[model samples]
Target: MTAQILDGKTLAQRLKGQLQTWLAEVSPQVGRPPGLAVIWVGDNPASAAYVGQKQKSCAQVGITSFGGQFPAHTSQGELAHLIQQFNQDERVDGILVQLPLPADLDSTKLLHTITPDKDVDGLHLVNLGKLLRGEPGLQSCTPAGVMRLLGHYQIPLAGKQAVVVGRSILVGKPLGLLLLASDATVTFAHSRTPDLAGLTRQADILISAVGRQGLITPQMVKPGAVVVDVGINRTPAGLVGDVDFVGVQAVASYLTPVPGGVGAMTVAQLLLNTVQSYGQRHELVMPQFSG
Candidate 1:
């Protein structure tokens, strides 16, 4: 069977429209628009592209954007100080430090400096702890986005076997927890996991978050299983995901495209998190979206 596309781009646009309407109604009462601060360092091309997309999305959703790009040589102390400033800024509802900071900088320390409430990226220890406890908190964008997309599509997860192919804190580990919370039996496989294809073929829901191109071949996928490709690999041909798209499209029941799938949802969820934080701060009731 030819797999149906998950079509995250359309869903993301719909979500943004919803946010715009909500902000229009609430901004007047709150006395100011929800504000998001993005602290970007260095000249990483990918990071620059992501930051631009985030700022553009913020404008669309009526969220004020703050913070600016810093040079590669910017020190850890300076970044920590800036995070503290945003934490104390009443106008700022969310603070995010673009990842892949200079190698010399301590990313964990800088991330921790942002207060838990304003940590929209949801990488702070406090937020992670909340996730570990299955409590309400800002969630890491990509994994949250994946769950949102699946929920929007009405994909079943309860009592199903789900395999997550990655181990990084950003996506794989947290995503495993989310799947578990939905009552799916979860398995995490990494580069060292022997017979990766065997593990993947048994999954009712297969997710590949490792950044390796063409990692999840059609042979590795179980027929009728749902596949979510979260990898973002930049090649000369353009952006691609971990799965072999053309091949897997014929084998799997559903699939998420690279550029338009998880990527679009991630930005949408970041905006959603910022709005949620804003609503909480103002004692406003935020409407819940599916998943």
Candidate 2:
């Protein structure tokens, strides 16, 4: 049977429409639009593309942009000072530092400088802690986007065997905690995990966030399992996800495409997180969308 596509591109568009409506409704009361500051360090092409997409989405949803690109040699103290400036800016609701910072700059240290309330990227430990405790908080965009996609399709999560391949703090670890919060029995596999196929074959819901293309082949997937490929790899063939999409499509019951799937939803969730922060700052009730 051909797999049903988990079309994140379409869903993200719909979510953006909803956000636009919400922003229109609240901007009058708040007297200002919600704002997002996306700080990009260095000139990484991928990071630049991602930041551009985010800023464009912000404008579409009436969120103001309070950010700019930084030089490659910008110092940690300089970046930290900028983050603090955004944190204190009443017009700014979210602050995000683009990743793969210049080799000398400390990403972790800079992340800590952003106020937790305005940390829309949800990489701050405070928000992650809230997620671990199953409380309401801004979540990492990609993982939060995954959960939102599954919920939208009304996929079963309770008591399912969910395997998350890759244990990065950015995606895997937090995503596993999210699935666990949904009552899915979660196991994390990484580079060192032995017999990887053996673990993946048992998953009812398989999520691969590792950047390695073609990592999850058809043989490794359980028949009829839901496969979400969060990987974005630039290959000889252009862009591809972690799963061998053509092969796995013949086995899995549902799947997400590389560029249009998790990537699209990631930006969508970032907007949602910003709106959430905006609402909190103004003591206004924000619209909450489930599934």
Candidate 3:
């Protein structure tokens, strides 16, 4: 059978519809729409695209998004001050600072300064700690999006041999944690892993987050394994995922496409997180997505 394309863009559109309905229900009680603040410190094209998509998703869901753009040379102190101000702003329920900040900026310190409640990115140590402890907290959007895709497709995770490639705090580490929470036996592989393809072949659930071009080929995937490609690499051929899609599609049972799969769900989950964060802060419970 030809592998089913996990259409994240379509899924995102449906999820955004749910967000609109949820917002409509709660806006009356809250007396305002949920708000999201996105702060970008530099002019990186890719990051700008990601932030713009996020803001657009917010608008589609009827959430008020405040976009803050800062100069490339903006100091760490200035950035922290903006975060502090957002933390205190009653109108802003979620705060996101775009990643891969300027080379000289202290990303760790900047993440730590955001109030844990408003940490919509789920990068704060406290939030990460909560996830590691299997508690209910805002989860990282990309991983959360991956889970939504898996659930939508009804791919079982319990007792599965899952492998996550890459160890970045953003995608790999937290995604591994989420898989473990679902009762999957998780193994995390990095660039240093010897014979990466061999480890990949053992996975029942394979996720590639390594930011390299066509890093996962057909030979690396086991027959009928589920593959999720999370990389966003730009090349002359256009956007490419970690997995070499043409090759792996022949071998994998399920696969996510680069431009339309994980990427779309990521923004969808960001909007979900913003609404969820708003509900949590105000002691209101939003209806879970029943789709």
Candidate 4:
């Protein structure tokens, strides 16, 4: 059977519209718009594009964008100091440090500098700990977005076999935890995992977050499994995902497209996290948006 598309772009747009409407109604009472500080460093083209999209999304949803690009030579101490400043800024409800900071800079240290309340990227140890404990906290955007997409589609998770084909803290590891919390039996596979296809074929839900293109082929997928492709690999043709889309589309029952799927959801969830932090800070009741 041909697979159904998950269509995250449409869902993301709907979420943005809801946020815009809610923010328009609440900003007057709040006296200021919720703010997001995105600290981008260097001139990485991909990072620049991502930052622009995030800023544009913030403007659409009434979240003021703060922070700007820094030079590649910008020191770790300088970045840390800036994060501290954003941490203390009352108007800024969320702080995010764009990834792949200069090799010399300590990304972990800089990330930790942002207070847990304002760590919108949810990479801080505190937030990760909260996730480990299954407590309410700002979640890593991509994983949260993946979970949101799965929930939106009403895919069964309880007691199902869910295989995550990556182990990075950002997406794979955390996403496994999310599936486990939903009562899905979760398995994690990585580069060194033996018999990768054998592992994936056993999954009811298959997710590939590893950035390698064409990692998950049709033969690796279980017929009728839901496949979520979180990879964003740029090639001469265009951006593509880990899954062999055309091949897997015929194998898996449901699938997420490369550009319009998890990537769009990531930005949407970042906004959601920021808004959630804002509501918590102001003691305002935030309305839930469901699929």
**Is candidate 2 or 3 superior in lDDT?**
2
* Shift of residue 99 alpha carbon in model 2, Å: 0.6
Q: Which sections of candidate 2 miss by over 4 Å?
A: none
Q: Deviation in angstroms for 87 in model 3?
A: 0.3
How many clashing residue pairs, candidate 3? 0
> Residues 95-145, candidate 1, lDDT per residue (tens digit)?
999999989999999999999999899999999999999999999999999
Q: What is the C-alpha lDDT profile of model 3 across 185-270, one tens digit per residue?
A: 99999979999989999999999999898799999998999999999999887898989898899999999998999999888988
Q: Against the hidden true structure, what lDDT does model 1 obtain?
A: 0.95
lDDT of each structure?
A: 0.95, 0.92, 0.91, 0.95
Provide TM-scores for the models. Answer: 0.99, 0.98, 0.98, 0.99
lDDT at position 155, candidate 2: 96
Q: What is the lDDT of residue 257 in candidate 4?
A: 98
Q: Candidate 2 lDDT, tens digit per residue, 1-291?
A: 678999999999999999898788879978999999989988898898899999999999899998899899889898999999999999999999999898898999999899999988888889889998999888999999999999999999999999999998899999999999999999999999999999999999999999998899999999999999999998777789999999999999999998899999999999999999988888986666542
Model 4, 85-178: lDDT tens per residue? 9989999999999998889899999999999999999999999999999999999999999999999999999999999999999999999999
TM-score of 1: 0.99
